[model samples]
Target: AKYRINAFHELSERASQTYTTKQMTMEGVGEASRLGSKIINCKDVSYFWEGGCLLKEFSYNFQRFDKVEIVGRNGVGKSTFLDLLTGVLQPSSGVIERGESLVIGYYRQEGMDFTGDDTVLDIVGDTRLLGRFLFPHDMLNTRVSRLSGGEKRRLYLLTILMKNPNLLILDEPTNDLDIVTLNILEEYLKEYGGSLIIVSHDRHFLDRVVDHLLVFCGEGIVKDFIGSFSEYRSYMRDYESAKKKDSIASIKPQSSAKPEKKAEDKPRKLSFNQKRELESIESRLPELEEKKAAIEKDMNSGALPYDKLKEAAELFKQVSNEIDELETRWLELQN
Candidate 1:
């Protein structure tokens, strides 16, 4: 966060000769690419360190068109395995084998290497493509050092795509990106003709970008499940809920299993007014959610300007707050 300070040079720099031309295309991404027409397999992969092993026996058969997303609670070594896949870290015991043609474009969560004082135009030679990416003509002469944090991240993405890698690995890419940019990135990922491996907590983005998940269970175990992030969350919720119900049922008839509620603490029957309010909330919450989804659909198009996007995002936030309040109240009434 501290390193993203902007300190670009002004109009004194030469703008014409500094810029070069590069184009993004998917033409040559054939079987020759590292992400060729096959899967990159991890066979019983495990990573060890001085203190302890980070991951154990993780295996996944990742293939092109897989659009895999990895999910787990923090400190589960999601990033560690990404490093192993990228060859940055080695597994103590298992194997991570890449396809014959694998060109990986990795975007880490933070701290990208900025080699030198390359201007915005210098980094991306063609001004038109830069413009498409929201870099203005005047800003083209600005140094990469002068760009804002979000601007720098967007530029980093540009550089990555310019490499035309067939395998894309993006780790927590939505962290600093605004909603507008996130939506745009989602669209790009949808149309990208490459294999994708993303590690993110943004459920909306994951649902749109990834087709399945690699869930990390603790103690170095990883489970490969076929579904979107939302689907996985729903599954986990159901599992936890069922487990809780089973636990409650197991001890239900035991005399000393649990203390009974005091007479005054018993749940009261809903009053007429409370019942009316509950029904109203149940109806209103769906409307609010539907409105939020519509706003999200428009924002995802990335057609709004910064100011308009912020306005729409604020409205979306308000809708979300309303839904949350209504749901909370509804639960209270039910109790």
Candidate 2:
């Protein structure tokens, strides 16, 4: 624990140095561009909760008209980092500094702050630019709760765009959005001139929108690479390869390093309800697989009747959906 604390402190120091260097670099670059002169700066930022570390020693700088993508697996502190950037969550340590003229527009993943009574049109109307772009002309009267998931996402984006902020921070912007809406968002962001820091798992969307990548690995490590998603993937592959080779070369003739002791000795136990659900899922999986195979066989066979084929296709779809839902539930129980 003490060594971990010291490592974190060292990382914080390094982040602070990086932050200072970025600040000086931006100042030297001069600001009189068409996209506005403001720069968004994040200094040695660290956040933790209930003795669990979320973000550790993170720092990045965004200049006018730059688009940066934040990438990492789930629970890697991407959302937490965004919250800190937008002043929603205070960092456990370090500081964040923004330019005096900077304005920030943020879109969160939860969609919680929106009121149900407000129609989609009314919400969009409040963000005049978004209303124009999304529901142009008298369409602002639609109720928010009545809109589809994709429509709600568009409305949310429009609201943030209305602020005309020099910097935008989007957290998991593509999750649950339909493909059509995702394309529209890509088009809009391509033309957007302001700085952007977007967190997303959609690799295609990231490739379309961002020129740089920032990754928080959930350790005390943060990685920054300039280029697209494809480039990031290549870098990661090479890095992993090098790490593997080094690990192999360092192997001792005697034995490998002992595995570290886990904090909890006992394995987590599932409740009766959870065990029942898991068993139910396990029971249905074989049936679902069998049904899926039968449907595929029917569809492939030339002698199958048209009505039978259609029925098989529909049944297959339903079975697949149910299987997906059941698997998600099972995973939740295990976790």
- Candidate 1 lowest-lDDT run of ten: 1-10
Give the TM-score (vs. native) of candidate 1. Answer: 0.67
lDDT leader: 1
Which regions in candidate 2 have their CA more than 4 angstroms from the true location?
1-38, 112-120, 126-138, 243-335
TM-scores of all candidate predictions against the true structure: 0.67, 0.61
Model 2, position 190, has a per-residue lDDT of: 70
Please give, for residues 1-335, the per-residue lDDT of candidate 2 as tens digits: 11122212333343333322222234213212234444656677778888878877566555665677876656667787778887888889877887777778888877545687997656655644554346655556767777777677777777777676667788877765644456567877776656778976555457777876675555645766567765655554454455546555655576455444221322345678876776787687668767766765666676768787667766755765675566445434533
* Whole-model Cα lDDT of every candidate shown, in order: 0.67, 0.63
List candidate 1 stretches off by more than 4 Å: 1-34, 126-129, 136-138, 241-335
Q: List the residue pairs that clash in candidate 1.
A: 7-146, 8-146, 20-125, 33-101, 34-101, 34-102, 35-101, 35-102
RMSD of each: 14.9, 10.5
How well is each residue in 1-335 modelled by candidate 1, as lDDT tens digits?
Answer: 01111221211221111211121244343222445545467767788777676677665556556577876766768898889999988889988888777788888866465645888878877665577667888888888787788888888877777676788889888766766677668777776777788987555557787766676665675655567765654564454455546445555465653355322233334678886786687567658767888998888787989898889988876775576556445434432
